[model samples]
Target: MSKVLSKEFLQRWAPLIVLFSLCIIVSIINPNFLSVRNFARLATSSAAPLMLAIGVTFIIIMGSIDLSMEGVMAFCGASLAVVMLQFNSFVEWGFLAIPVAIVFGVAIGFVNGLIHVKLKIPSFLVSLGIGFSCIGLTMVMTGGVRVSASDKAFRLLLTERFFGFPLMVYVAFAALLLAYFIQKKTALGRNLYAIGGGEELAHASGVKVERVRIIAFALAGAFYALGAMFAVAQIGSVASNLGTGFMFVSITSVVVGGTALMGGIGGVWQTLVGVLIVAVISNGMVLVGLPTYIQEGVLGVLVILAVALATNRKAIQLVK
Candidate 1:
């Protein structure tokens, strides 16, 4: 009875406790950690990665991984930049250009899904390939050149205040709200969790696992493209390496947010917390004077600890 109670307590409260503890520690380390400016920066810094994490959250919960995000983001960002650049025919696309970029993203995602489902390819291998292809596509688009947006209206988003925060911050919150709704109220969302809990059982229970998987991936792709677009907007430019290092950080945010690696657990709320934590850590380190070289290692060790605590390992028959 005690053991069961302890397990329940850990499952319900451990991650939140750790998150608060981390926040307290960081705050103590840097007295100015709670400043409004710092939080605004955290929101903006987290915006793109938060979207990427949300994109992959469904896949991860369905017991699959997406390693293609960085590539997809770079490719999508480069594509959008190329479309909006002043020097090309594509530049004349006007406001309709955003939809074009989104459609392009859906295409990439659809291909990733179709190929994975039809061929039974492992997501890890397939996503990595997709990612590399995206990077290559970006390279082909740019030939080692950077394209900056000249649109003041678009670029103004990074600094434009909406209520008390930047416009992009509200956009991020809207994405979060939409994700939460999908997770809580949609058949597709419930199907995703069921599939994660047990793919074989889900298959037997009348769930169209393949179809749902494909939709999930395609949705993920759309979000990734949106993230890339926002990222480009934030920086006002795009390059072949636009999405470099994202997979690691976004995955870390997801895992650290208490999503189990083995799937069937975690959600958007956890992911939001995780993204904020990661952003706070990045900001706090600079405030507290921590060296850049050590931050990755620190985050890595934290990730391992987070994974161990988040996963209910004793129930698993195997680890692979």
Candidate 2:
């Protein structure tokens, strides 16, 4: 009984515990890890991943997974750059590019959800197919070349700082707040949890499971669009590879933050902790002189450990 209780406690608090523990361990190794400057940098680095994780959190809570982030992000980033370039800057009418990018993402996500729900296809497979298609479309649009969106006004997201952190961090925080609201205060959010708990039961309870799933996916795409904007801002350019590596980072952060891949067990707040945890580990590893390969290995191990502790194995008899 004691052992079971301990496991439950750990599962409930693992993300927070892991975050604080990583902070302490890294600070001990390199005191600079605790410095305000380093923290600011970490916040900047974490902003994009946080947005991506937040977007995916909704889908995950619905017991579905989205592997379309990389392709979606890249396509959106490229689209933003191309659209902004048409007007030469983010001033006046050029600002329209932002919404255009977000709407594009929403459409893509809507279609993805529609196919998944209507065609009886698996979520992961459907998303993966759409992701690849998006990537191919992006490549065609850009002619296999990088598009530059270095407009000074738009780049302010990364260049300009207020209160010791970049504006992008604040934007990410705002996104987080909105996502939290949708997840907690809205009917859709409640329905998501209901579906995740058990889809058939949710449908039997009169919940419009299919509609909620579509909306959740569309909302996630909007967040991914925001992530793409931040990613472009951080680099001042866009390419087919603009979203490279985000898949590993965002999903890892989401899971590490304690949102179970099996779903119905986490939130955006947890995703925030997970993003910070990943940022700290990556930054700390660099500060301590660890090679890239080792950092990757450490992250993989951390994900496995987090899932092990967070998963209620007894509740899930079939591995699937």
Which candidate leads the pack in TM-score?
Answer: 2
**Candidate 2, 1-320: lDDT as tens digits:** 79766866877787788789989999999999988899999999999989999999999998899999999999999999999999955886788999999999999999999999999898889999999899999999999998999999999999899988999999999999999998999999999999988999999999999999999889989999999999999999999988878877888899898888887779999999999999998998888888756766777888798778777778887886
Task: Give the alpha carbon lDDT tens digit for every residue of 1-320 in model 1.
Answer: 79766976776666677778877988898868778777787788899999999988888999899999999998888777777764343335544556767777778888888889999999878999999998888888889798776566666667688755788888888988998999889999999999999999999999999999999898888888888878988998888888988888888888888787788888888888888788878887888898866767877997898888777667889877
Report the Cα lDDT for residue 268, model 2.
Answer: 96
**Structure candidate 2, residue pairs in collision:** none
lDDT of each: 0.84, 0.90
| Most accurate candidate by lDDT | 2
Q: In each prediction, how many residue pairs overlap at the backbone (N, C-alpha, C within less than 3 A)? A: 0, 0
TM-score of each: 0.93, 0.96
**Global lDDT for candidate 2?**
0.90
Q: Where does model 1 exceed 4 Å of error?
A: 1-5, 86-93
